[model samples]
Target: MATTINEIIRDSLELIKAEHLNLTPDNYAKVFCKVAKQKGVIVEDCQKVDKYTKKLDPNIVTDMKRFNIGNIDELLAFLVAKLNRANEGDALKMVNTLATLTKRVLQAITLLHDTKATSLANASLERLDFHQNLQSIDLVKEKWFDFISNYDDSYLKKLDAFGHVTKDDLEVMVRDLIKILSKDDSTELYKTLVPLIIASLSPSIASGMNDELASISNELRNSPDALGTPALQQEIKHLISKRIDLDKAEVQKKVAALDKILDEINKKILELIQSSNFSHEQVKVIKKDLQSINFQQDSFETVQVKLLNIASSLESETRSLSEKMISNQETITKLQNRISKLESALLVAKQEVKEDYLTHVATKRALANEMNRVEDAFMRYKIDYTLCFIDIDHFKMVNDTYGHEAGDVILSTVGKILRKYIRQVDFVGRYGGEEFLVILPSTELAQAIHFADKIRAIVEQFKFLYKNERINVTVSCGVSQRSQQKSKDETLSAADGFLYKAKEAGRNQVMPVL
Candidate 1:
């Protein structure tokens, strides 16, 4: 019988939970490493942070137990709590690294899933007579509802939730799968494995192809077009691991060694000419003769013993070149890894300046980024843009009445409302709790007021329901345009001042009076 993909996912999740009874950062990493090793995924010391496990605080384990990072529903709550007291980067890394390691666990599950399918298919064939097997194989095949209800696609989202996965990670994962499945001879499973492994490797090949990799890619492409055999997966690991080197230094050294050999012949010729007490013309003739005894296919060495000297030099250079090429390949491999590290570091930096985790709008850092662009436009073209500083009226009441989770829902909903209603050219970002910023380009003061008023009304009318409790939400906006402000800060201050005025006058209103 075909098992639902969710059953596999649930089992996979349970397996992780079972691996370690306590799911703190330290225990999580330890369990992850163990699971990966058991599943045939190789981990270099450079890729792990096991040594840091000793440094974890005792309090974190206790706190994590209360929050229960194991439960998906409580995950955000745990993160929100951690972010308040922990180093921001450390908190994010704890989440991101856990997600990344869990991907390895999922890859192992995929391999196990493949192995199970293979065993079942083989069993079905052997259990039946040949003609009966041909007709009854539909039992092995999947059904329509199996396709409809299966949740295999959630694995991709689950993997991407906390970390930025790369092509190299995918290739390594697929390679492990291929190694484990190498013994599976079932033609049915071979068809399944070929495409999955190929798909895993496709992104790596497509994204990072050089001269040598292109040839391998063509071979992989050709294999799928043909039998789509199990052997295709077998060869993919070898193809991806191939590296080439053409060492110019080795070539130059070889040429220099040959030159030294030729130079020795001239030295000996000069000595012979001097010892023989030859005339000046005879010395010139000897020089010409030695030069003529060149290292060429058509030439012959008159000194029979010199061939050994020249041959020895040639052999030495060949050995040196071979050694140099090996060294170069190793160096290139390390360089590629270093480049991946640098790219990953760059990704970390980019991740810092992104949408608000709680609200899903532009974070404060992102707001500053957008402001810089808006400033650039205003300076260069003298273009005008409006900035509206918004504060949710009586927002503290929502938190007081409905709880923080409901408040979070209201915040996120308001962000979505402002983000959705704004022009694409405009910008909307969450400034802080209960505060938002919106920028409208080329808009007059009246239009800015009208737009802010419209958003205020939308938020007021829209209902936010959390845990069977309904709450009314409204926002007060203070509007300012860039036409008169001297700088970005001044424009922001003007909007902020008006926002304060609006709040002072009464909540739930737009402050259009400059």
Candidate 2:
């Protein structure tokens, strides 16, 4: 009996899912290439597809009989038919054909979500590298360790809650961008393992026990009730214990290396905390803030969300409390005014009872309580905002032509422009060189896109000066909005994919995904 097409697609998808591949365009090509080799489907021809597909050009399969690269609708229909016919013996042959078809469709969709994941990884790393205050044992061992450990999909999920990215979004996103300085090709293991490690750090993007994982877990289960629980529930704990048993020597070696780093950071923190020249009150406040900024998780996304939320809440609460205190302080002004009036009305009215300036200081304690409330609220709502990633068009050319100094000026100038256009409450940060990330609290994608367009327009019209030369700049933007229960990394990636299209379609445009 001949195998059906849908079955082939299903099996292929399962294979990808089993391997935790994100169905990226590049990975999709790889999957097809693997399938073709296994089924002996003109491996050389498949290699041609891989070569052309990697370039992301559309002419790769112009002559392939099974593929209709021009009509996505027709191609998808045929691919679906092939998927319905999947079987173990002939599955690879059909999947290879479907892969060529899907690759075209995906290229149109773009899969920059992997890129976004990469971005988040870099952002989280920046947070770790620049934090500068890791002085206590708790901060060093607990906070930093936890931040590094949990830097996977969960971070993206939290960002999604903030309305930045979504899950399984059919768009190209740039995720997990690790900077590779070393040229040794022997680093394939390092390259592959690094992204996986970074992805794992973000619990949001990390694949949980899917059907394939479930099968593996079932084989390892010791109890009849194992079916009820996911293997990931005990994944970390189990891995730790298993490593202790199977690779005790390796664990000890890493422990010795890690201990040296921890001691150095702790010593630095202690020195700052114990300085005799600093005021006792200042030390107390520093300690208090340090205690509040707890880093219990190993994921950078987790740490960033927690720390930023806490800091923002603390600042907001301080502002609110200060406002109220100012209002109360107005009463003192009124009383002082009244006392002046009495002195003017009566000759030598005994220098009106001396005002006690210290009385107002009591408000600080009350303000602390209000700050706690604000911090708690912030923690709840940090993930409830929307975020957009914006990339500047031909920014490198600007840098290369104008030099890094001029590039810095351009970046600073752009930052000011974005700040001016965006709402003061919206969070805008330099996502790195030539890229900016914006977080909109309580705003959806449609509203965000409108804002993005405004930024694009303002940027296009703006001119920068390097010495006497006038430089005009424009930007290409991709806008992605997060769905209610999706991963932020994927959503950001989708927006990034749109941005890529914006560039491809021509620079200086806003391409927002619906």
Candidate 3:
């Protein structure tokens, strides 16, 4: 039987699920663009687009459009083909627009399925009027299902050919969805389907199926049956017959590397021993150096035992490290939840407590402590992502015109929203009056800037209703990811400069210098 479109989509989804990696929107966008182009829907060829453009998935129309995914697919393919054909520097410029589209699509997709409305989701739906007549689109839903069932097997094969799906890969897939959905932002189809694609990549998102292939190495090493009596073992000939080829290429490479290291160490030792200043003191230093080398040799020898002792050590190390990373991730998550709760509590307390100087100082102290806790957590990861500071554009006017109470409300509202929008790994603090700082762990400047834009939009659109008068607010933001060490003053000064620039250019924008 020829596969229906729904079956094709379903099988493709299954193939995606079979992999042990997270399927990000970027991956789907790339694959979708490839498939759409192959089907002659997209104008450009997949080979021509840059990785980010491919992730964007520009302009492909489908019989069943979901979240302009088809449009994104077509556009990305066209851009990719165009870029490759032209081989121009403009490819870099394409990234900003692609990234913006990606954010819009992702935010939109998240909202369509969300029963509970989040600010991002609400904004997406609002932009497209996605919620209006949303519950009454049965034909659209049916067509989408049919499209998935009859999706081509060749497309799945193409996806497999793309090979390993990394975080970057996943982003491409999402961008593709965005492109398709962008065509008819009025439709909520892409918004519905994008999440479903993400769902398929769940296994990869979980414990990682990549580890499964090597897990047998550990089981064989630990199995008592492998070491049982010969007579008993003789009954199961297959036990000894099984000679699973474990990839020793990496081990061999390591061995070669170690040998080179040893050679260098030996040369150094010989030089010390033959030194003109050779004496009891020199001899002692040589012995210490030799002991250090021996200690390393001992460690390597211990590791080599498994490789040489009919049991590979790869399993033990991979499992151990994976577990540690997972635990650390969980710890970060818990800490984030705790911090969010604390922020909410503090905000509530601000409303309840008297706005006296002593109270304000005490509250500020508490907020600072929370920020410190977030910094400590980042320290444990030994990552450079926690670098952050805040700038509130010339806010003396708010204090002067709006009265201190209104200024307080504005500050509090901004602080609350910042805390809410940021992920668990991110931190926000009241650095000083009309100034707040936010630290983002594991984020690059580009990512931080994108997030800042999203938050800025939220603040701009927020309805500040106080005593029946409507209040509108705007902010200038400067975001950067710290990759090198600089004095605190210097770093803050640079960020402040960016904020000033943004204000100069026009407030309500995020400027990031990489």
Candidate 4:
């Protein structure tokens, strides 16, 4: 007698347990089929599926194998998806063909030079533009067919008035006429506008941009036609942006210097007030008024005006003390000399704040400021950026074997290398000892990685000479994109993480393995 279904299931479970296999459905099914076959009972379902699969198209069979479709349900879903995708491809092709047809028809219609023909062409072009996708292709086709059916040939008669003029000749004549009109309009407009623009720029700001402005002015006057090209327009825009950034940087430097000067002057006044024995009530009142000025809360102009008034009062009061304080004349002269020296020192301090003393590149503080600025641009304008975190390999060993002086040389050389390779807009800074951060504005991850690798290769090939001893050096770099991270800090962390990974995977390489 044939094995009963209950007996087959019982034996399948026993076999699974005996073999120490997991009691999964697939395992149970295989065991059950094996036991049934031993008892002379054929499982017809497996046979049916195999037979059906053999009848499918070879390409479909290959696709099933490629996708690992093991059962009928999955196979059916895959086939349905494949069919849907094919239908979409066909629909896209049809839409593209329709668009091309409509564009060609419009081009042919525009050559007739009739007002009605031009209007019809423009309307059809607008409709085609509106229906740019497969979903609206049917409506576009209907409108295009209607336009083609109603198109009149009477417009061609106007062309016959120009005796023996071929269609090609008419086309050339129309194109030449349009070109002349466009050139004259653009040239006259530029001529009238360029002088006014140049005149409006402040002499102080425009002094540095004289060459750029002159180049542009000459272009407008001599080669106005070239300005119509996209390349020339982009060059002009770049020059404008460069000039704006330069002016902004100069203004910021001046403001920072002024701020430092004001602070120093306030400190000197306070010191003089504390040390002075003011016998006059007016001198005491002037000191009290000077102390009342709020540097932090008040605007720069307001602070300047108040300080000026206080200085005038102090000047008048001090005149009376000149005879009484004659013995302190040397001290006063020394203080004046000290103030001058302090001014110079303050300027140097400001420079040091932005520049690293050892590396001569930007300092970490400056890098942070740049990162914040770049982050603002990213957040506000959707402009993307990338960071490269670089660490010199075996730097500690270099310092140990050589000396701290040699290490400094290495750091300085690396900084110079980084600065040399980067663009004007890109920033490279000494993040800390033996490490650097490069901020690449408007850069992509892949491009940044490539850049980092190039830097790595350059450093590896460079020779470090200290005390006439050659030292071999290499660097590991990590790169990350701002767009890939949720925050600027995260982006920096990611770059650092990649840098660590690069160091771990045998230094002197760029991270993310690519």
Candidate 5:
């Protein structure tokens, strides 16, 4: 009843095929063991491999299971392969760590802001880059070692002159320098400002404060340095307060004098009514109202109301009195109309200065104001913004070929598009001819670049028509974030530089190509 070895072998081959397993040695041995056991033959267990595998690390045992490593030879090969991969990974990690360290070192050197340090950092960067491209970590390490060993830190001593060269120290130094300069400037400013303040005083007000004004002016001119002391500053503030009080008193005095003049006129009118026999209901009403008027109130509104009521009563009285009153009323109305016209003209002039006539966006003056506002916000709150410098491509050519009118239309259209797309918090302005500045508050550089690209595409696709002729138009944009630069002007200049790059690369594109 026992199976022969050849029959067991034949049965193992058939079972392997039936089980849809590969005919490898491990599969054959396992199947052969199974077949022999079924035929009542004693067979060796293939599970003996597990005893050795269990003695290995759990991770290795898992790998053996995964890779089907049944024998010692297979296990050895897998272990070797795993070891090779781990070695490669560790080498990569070491190289990355070195690169990161080198980068950080270069950044620190750059922050020193010294010419020599910058030169050394640049050279090191070049060498690091060369080694990194070659993937030779040993060479990189050697180069770094040589840089450190041969590096002369003598130049660093110069930074000690700046007192530790920290941010706080630099800020303190700047403050001290500004204080000194401001003190010098203040002497001259006080000399000029005090005289101007004195000259602006009205004659009535000036009479009362003349002695104080003359003394302050003489002190400011002759001993301007005295203003540096706190005592002198307090004295000047006291003088200013006295001048304000004098002005208020002068205003009240003038109001009282006008009230007296009105009272005299009312008495004269009442006398004329009584003496001329103009006895009517109008006369009674006017008499009653004038008598009831309280001139002692000393308030302008009360006087004006009383005057208006008397004028209303006088107008209805008689033709002769009415004619004279109408003449006076016409004169006053003309003066008021003239004043209103002047105010309206002033307002229009101011608006014209702040807004461009053709584009309806902010003028360069307004843009400057907005820039200052944005910068103040940035410096005070660390709230960042971005500047997008935009220029119409081939603008000069458009002007030359299609006339300046067409160019104006293009400029106006571009400005409108820019203004339309921006958020309410953003600003768009005509920086100059064919140039616009868009300020994106709280925007990152990447977001600004995206916004600029969107605008560029919109401008390029727009159908610009002048005199029924289709004209091609496009724009180049340069964008920069405020925090990335040293100052507002530098940020603007950077945006302009990027714009130049965009134009040089090709028109109708955003610089930085993000």
Candidate 6:
């Protein structure tokens, strides 16, 4: 029984180390939970153990008395208590609360630092220092207090507008702030932050417009020309209600119409001015005729004043009309241009959805679709097809040693190499994680293996870099031909089996010994 306990503990720690996971107290607690559960034991309040200090040592978790479980028996009892104390959901909630509070304090510190509020930044950092000395529950409470106290009224109002603050809202705000921070303009930080907060108040004006436009389209399809239909006169009380939501092309057309309206208004106003000159000419003739009839001075002056006032009022009204027309035209043009860009972006996004964003290759869903197509061609036409599964060796170690950003760079580089080297007739896709699939149509195993070995050799010799540091990497591939397999699934299974064989025979080599 002691030997069983020792082996389990050793294997769990080794697995965690192999995965390159941080051997923090929380991770250690989790390991204990796993082993205890395996031994048919339940641990309650396991989160309590997670509160232990995150001291960096892979050995500490497996053998420390600081976690209050020095022996195997004590470990089992502790695990049972931890697991049974509360549900996993409650534990997750606690963890999220801690994370959110910590993030908020960090953001406050950043904001204060940018504003040259050195004193405030120091205080915030001191509070964090103060946090480390306290218990986990107290640490969380301290962070919350620091976060709420640090922000001013304006920031609070923004938070309030988000409506009953939650972790999700904080996460959104944090993500947006981080994006803005990349611009590195500290002067307009608050200015930028405010709009982002308000923008999050709803689904988005453009998205709402899209939905309204779709609804109108549906309504028209059911009864064609909904506005012009006489039967629905009761529904739309006004003869010309208001601006209706429209698509990009329709918006551009409306913008052009608005431009015409502006031009016509300007022309009519100019024509009105020309007519005023004619009116003045008529007034002069009237004055001459009145003088010939010996009219009174006071009467002539009064008539002239009335005509001048009328002309002045007409000119003022026309000027206002011209301004409005120009303003409306400019607004419509800008909106139309914005809509065109948005539609173009949406099209690109839809295309990207079908591709593996990181790899720039077919996504898993797309690969699945291609697999079905290839299988159909094989079954119907008896065409030969081969598939190779490729996996990167020691990918986790690369991530652990260099960082996830470096891992991403390496993955993208590998993807680029695969795409560049493969034939146009063959299809390559990211199967997921560090794995890729190369689907060869009308090709035999011999041909597939040759291609695999070539790719393997290229990757082995390829010089990869992440942050100016050179990194070496290799791939192991399993090649299989679809000859006797009953279906696509069976063929893939055989390919996976060979891929594992490649890994077992020492990575950086292809399967089937050649």
Name the top TM-score candidate. Answer: 4
| Selected candidate, larger lDDT, 4 vs 5 | 4
**TM-score, model 6 to reference:** 0.36
For residues 204-247, what per-residue lDDT tens digits would candidate 3 score against the true structure?
A: 11222323323332333244344244653453343222222122
lDDT of 5 at 198: 39
Residue 332 in candidate 4, Cα distance off native in Å: 3.1
Q: Pick the candidate with the highest lDDT.
A: 4
Tell me the tens digit of each residue's lDDT in model 6 across 1-514: 6777677678779867875557877677567677766776545554344444244244546545555553345656655666586776887898778856865766676664345344544555565655555475455555545655574646545655434443345567566655654655443454333322222221211232434333433444354334344664443332112223323445565446435533443444444344543433443443343334322222133333433333344344443444343435564355346535644664565566568889888888778877876785455434558999999999999999999998999899989999998887689899979999999976778889999999999999999987778999999999888875887998899888999999999999988765
Ranking by TM-score: 4, 5, 6, 1, 3, 2
Tens digits of per-residue lDDT for model 2, 33-123: 5665565554453455345445543442342343533233444555566568556568777756674664454354333445644444444
* Model 1 lDDT, full chain set: 0.60
After superposition, which runs of candidate 5 have C-alpha atoms over 4 Å from their true positions?
1-329
Model 5, CA-based lDDT: 0.72
TM-score of each: 0.34, 0.29, 0.31, 0.45, 0.38, 0.36
lDDT for each residue of candidate 4 in 289-359, tens digit (9 for 90 to 100): 55565443222444345445545655665655544454666656664675566556655666777899988
lDDT of 1 at 457: 92
Q: Which stretches in model 6 have alpha-carbon errors above 4 Å?
A: 1-331
CA lDDT, every prediction?
Answer: 0.60, 0.51, 0.50, 0.73, 0.72, 0.63
Candidate 1, residues 414-482, lDDT tens digits: the string is 888887898877888889888999988778888999998999899889978898777888788999988
For every candidate, C-alpha RMSD to the true structure in Å: 37.0, 33.8, 34.4, 24.0, 21.3, 34.4
**Predicted candidate 2: what Cα RMSD to the true structure?**
33.8
TM-score of 1: 0.34
Measured with C-alpha atoms, the lDDT of residue 452 in candidate 1 is: 89
Q: For candidate 6, what is the lDDT? A: 0.63
Better of 1 and 6 by TM-score: 6
